[model samples]
Target: MSRNILRHWFSVLVATLAALAISSNAFANTKNYTVTAPDGVALSVQESGNPLGQPVVLIHGLLGSRLNWDAQVGSAELQRYRIITYDLRGHGLSGKPTEAEAYRDGRRWADDLAAVIEASHASRPVLVGWSLGGAVISNYLAAYGDSQIAAAVYVDGVIELKGDQIVAHSEVYRDMISSDLKTHLDGERTFLSLCFHTQPDRPTIERLLANAAMASWDMQSAVQSMTVAASEGLSKIRVPVLLLYGEHDALVNTSGAIARAKQLDPQIQIKLYANSGHAPFMEESERFNRDLAAFIETAVIH
Candidate 1:
């Protein structure tokens, strides 16, 4: 085997053994804190992996907390880099505002990300955003530009929230914000279910359901109208960009998202996971981590 391939396998083996030795639910040497956004929203943030290594900020999707990045944060191959994960304004342990203005304005989301980056003292961190997280990155780039970061990776990311790019699931979205608790919970379950081609274990699903349950109803309702700065943001990024999408995605038109991203910047890299769906980072995490590590190596150098 090639030296790189041997190293990859060695890392996987070490990670596997390390996982067996530690509790499955815990991240070792994790540091947790709260970063206040520009609008006074407190974002719950966590840092794991190698603290002294290059930083990587991980932004989760709608209805997801920082826990959504457990796979990436816990990987052995990824341990060489500092990993940062945070809860969005209306998600997880973060502050949740009921007002429509807080969720409708995309700049607020971007500012929240900036606040986390600034507070963490992360120098030129690589941004890895998933699903709705992609829109957050776009808005951030539009508002602040790419001078602060090294590179970006969008995993099954949503390029735009409207038009043919988004898969139609209007009823599920409507039910998500329903006043009736059962309807709302069921909607959340269905929405999470759509994220995978092969569903996770019952325990994992239950945990994710709990995470979704913690999300704000007002935010979910208002986020539908949030602006995505694809034209302004994607076009302006001078740093390397990679789009990793699943071939079987149920929630997004992967081809359309890729097309839009390429139209904005032809230099952006693209990778498709043929057997996976909306959550390819979770569905095919080993390969995803390997690919991410390879990209970061080149990104940091550039």
Candidate 2:
């Protein structure tokens, strides 16, 4: 070909490449970082979506990592909100302190969450907690109060662990605190199964089991032993609260918990996933995302 013809083709190719680069950057927008807790433990954090949008920090359940919120993080419905998800200490890529005392005291949980919020540069962001994460956020309220967050969404979580409520609600709680590894692992599997009304696929089950095995058993037991009752904090919260639970949740008393939460905070809104179990976020993601957006718009941003 002539020099002129070759140059024209090269220019077109360069323009195409530039467009592809811009598209790739837009598609891969998530950023990962680490936040060091007050106890000197580093927590892995992931932030995605529009940086200037409203922030929503998500905390995972027991043995669950930031990966649990992958659906929400990547959903187009939530693209307008800055989504932040982190691995709790002793789970996933976060630091694991072998000492039982680390988990026994609830300060670390609150501090870790606070560090994440500060790292995200988010003020009064909505905090979404799943399962044990409910306890973690409750602990945060107990320590830091509700000034830092605009609202809270509890996804089949434990808001009250006082008295015999937890023990009576689920046998898995007892197994989690048990000393026998076999019993604990068995309980973990059972708990995972109960999280969904239908059983998860083989790969998902294996992945969940692997994540559960990565947790420090001692730390799990230690945290489970600690008493976390958020009744007072819930009553005192100035921001609106949203509670989401599955109708067939075997691990927690969904109806009872919602009733108790409503009694404690009249501003609380509760939603039940008719076809789901413990993990309504994953099992019924579309509805969950829609409800979440509605809640944020009406109860929080507006």
Which candidate number maximizes TM-score? 1
TM-scores of the models, in the order given: 0.93, 0.86
User: What residue pairs clash in candidate 2, if any at all?
Assistant: none
Candidate 1 residues lying further than 4 Å off, grouped into runs, are: 1-26
Stretches of candidate 2 exceeding 4 Å from the true structure: 1-27, 167-184
Mind giving the per-residue lDDT tens digits that candidate 2 earns over 36-81?
Answer: 9999998999888778888899999988898788668767677778
Model 1 lowest lDDT segment of ten: 19-28
In model 2, what is the error at residue 297, expressed in angstroms? 1.2
- Decoy 1 TM-score against native: 0.93
Flag clash pairs in model 1: none
For 177-224, candidate 1 gives per-residue lDDT tens digits of: 899999999999999999999899898898899999999999999999
